[model samples]
Target: MNQPLTLEELKQVMAEADLLKTEADVEAALDKLAQEITARISESLPVVYGIMNGGLVMAGRLLTKLNFPLEQGYMHATRYRGETTGSTDLQWQAPPSVPMAGRTVLILDDIFDEGNTLAEVVKACHAQGAKEVLTAVLVNKVHDRKNTELKIDFIGMDVEDRYVFGCGMDYRGFWRNAAGIYAVKGL
Candidate 1:
């Protein structure tokens, strides 16, 4: 069997294969995303929502980049856990601490895979009577849409369905802290 793609291998592919598009090179893109989020909701103190589990690392990283005062909150909306594919059934584990009613809310998520989690979170935000609801994501998989109405207002990268890990995305419920993103070797 072939060796799994390690961090070094990802770096090699990133350099040689031009695997990441220049327009959305990871670091530059992240900086742009931070700027975009800052511009959209430039309030004194904004209630930022993190869709837990996957979004944990990304939201944390992005929050540190903001210039304005920010309050942190998290809600767990999961369509997939450790499984290779997504499931239709979505479960919300926790709700935001800050009152979402009539508040500026910025939702940070890991990936726009099936769109289920994104769509559900949007609905949840509305249900909480958010003054305005916005979204940001690390990756957007351009597959057939399970929920097309939802869109990622800010994105770090658009990736193919090769099972990515790192940059807040995960495979087998691990590898979130990887410096660069990676893919599974066989499937």
Candidate 2:
């Protein structure tokens, strides 16, 4: 509301968050993810599900980099729509269409905040009978591992909660367009 964060302040927080990834770094991560997806796409994978809204840009870009054929789908799940603290309860707008019975599924999200969302999503996938599920995320908020006791299978970039906007991440829904990524400055 109060001009959230100035460019300089944003830079400071990003430095504190240890988010030094440049624009090139983001692209390279996508490139690497594409290759990883391709390697995992062998043997008729069932579906690649993206946690909607936030995962849009990252998944869209990664989808282009896929060299092999892969089925793509979307599932809307909101954990922190209007709440400041991330939500532990996930609400799905729609269930995935592809059968999860003993099928391979790839789950993707924008950021790893508190691990609650990731953990619940993985649990849901398994509950639906997914034989094996691989989780992937673009930004890893390396603030406190003790708090976020969850592990990501394929990580694109390692950053703190400070440097966490752009390329799919957003700051109050404003800084998502930032090219190089940014960090929130104050409370």
Candidate 3:
């Protein structure tokens, strides 16, 4: 097994990271996403569900931009518990608390990488009788490996294939609070 990173080691990794998206860039993307979402679903009583841990930051930032009244909740579903890589199996730690039956549901997440997790979440909402399910992501990773047919409705930005951390994404379960998006050096 790989040893856990020390604080100083993690800091060094962050310091050497390649800046992919600056804070301003992320904010600008969010602003655009807010406008698009408002135009499409502002009047609808949408239930926004944040895919927890990773999605928290994106969801919080988006909620403030939205002008209309809507319900908010979070669900904890993860393929990477605290690792840089991912496993095929998904673990659902918690489900959304708010009811979704016959309602419009929006699922917000940090990144759309392989699209498996988002696809599963959308299916769950539909299984519970959601009238509609919409998807959004802070970053859409460019890759050829995809396992789902679901499409992200709102996208903040597109990033090249890299091991990214920050802006609600983590490095060894840390650095999710970093202001900008960063790709670790030599990853």
Candidate 4:
């Protein structure tokens, strides 16, 4: 395991980070996502699963704006486990909290980076008998390192390929609480 970053270092990390999207920007994006999602499945009574940790903030805020009745649950599958880079294997700390058999499933996450984690989650949902699975992300990192062909159904915004934190994304597992999206300096 890596040692924890010091408090001063954590502060410095944020201090030198570049603000990519403000809180207002994120909020507006959520509004747009909520509308798009509602237009597609508001009446389907979809089972919404927030991929834990990174999805926490985005799911919470987006859920409230959805304006539709749906079952909300969480799954804790991770490839990062707090590190910047992902491991080859996905660790399922927790499985789906609700059954998706014969139901429409919507997966919410913070970012669509390389697409491995989300792709695996979608497959799991299918194996559990979901009639259809859709994906939504707060940010889509622009790059060509995607490991899966899965496409995000809804995206709040596109960001440059950089190590990012905030709006539930973390830097060394810190700064997930930052209101705005930020890119780590020199990363």
Candidate that would win on TM-score: 4
Q: Rank by lDDT, highest first.
A: 4, 3, 1, 2
Give the TM-scores of the predictions, in the order they appear.
Answer: 0.80, 0.80, 0.93, 0.94
Q: What C-alpha lDDT values do all the predictions have?
A: 0.74, 0.73, 0.90, 0.93
Angstrom error of the Cα, residue 173, model 1: value is: 0.9
Give candidate 3 regions above 4 Å deviation. Answer: 79-90
In candidate 1, the residue pairs with backbone N, CA or C atoms under 3 Å apart (3 or more residues apart, or in different chains) clash, namely none
lDDT of 4 by residue, 105-130 (tens): 99999999889888888888898999
What is candidate 3's lDDT per residue for 127-159, written digit by digit as tens?
899999999999999999866588899999999
For candidate 2, give the lDDT of residue 68.
Answer: 66
C-alpha RMSD of each candidate structure in angstroms: 4.6, 4.0, 1.8, 1.6
Could you tell me the lDDT of residue 3 within candidate 4?
81
Model 4, 46: alpha-carbon shift in Å? 0.7
Judged by lDDT relative to the true structure, which candidate is superior, 1 or 4?
4
Would you give me the overall lDDT of model 2?
Answer: 0.73
Per-residue lDDT of model 1, residues 1-187, tens digit only: 3346777765554454313233236567678889988888876367898887888888887788888888888888766664546676666667676788878888988788778768877887898798888888877776785477886788877877777777777654556766566666543
lDDT of 4: 0.93
lDDT of model 4 at residue 60?
Answer: 94
Name the lDDT value of residue 61 in candidate 1. Answer: 77
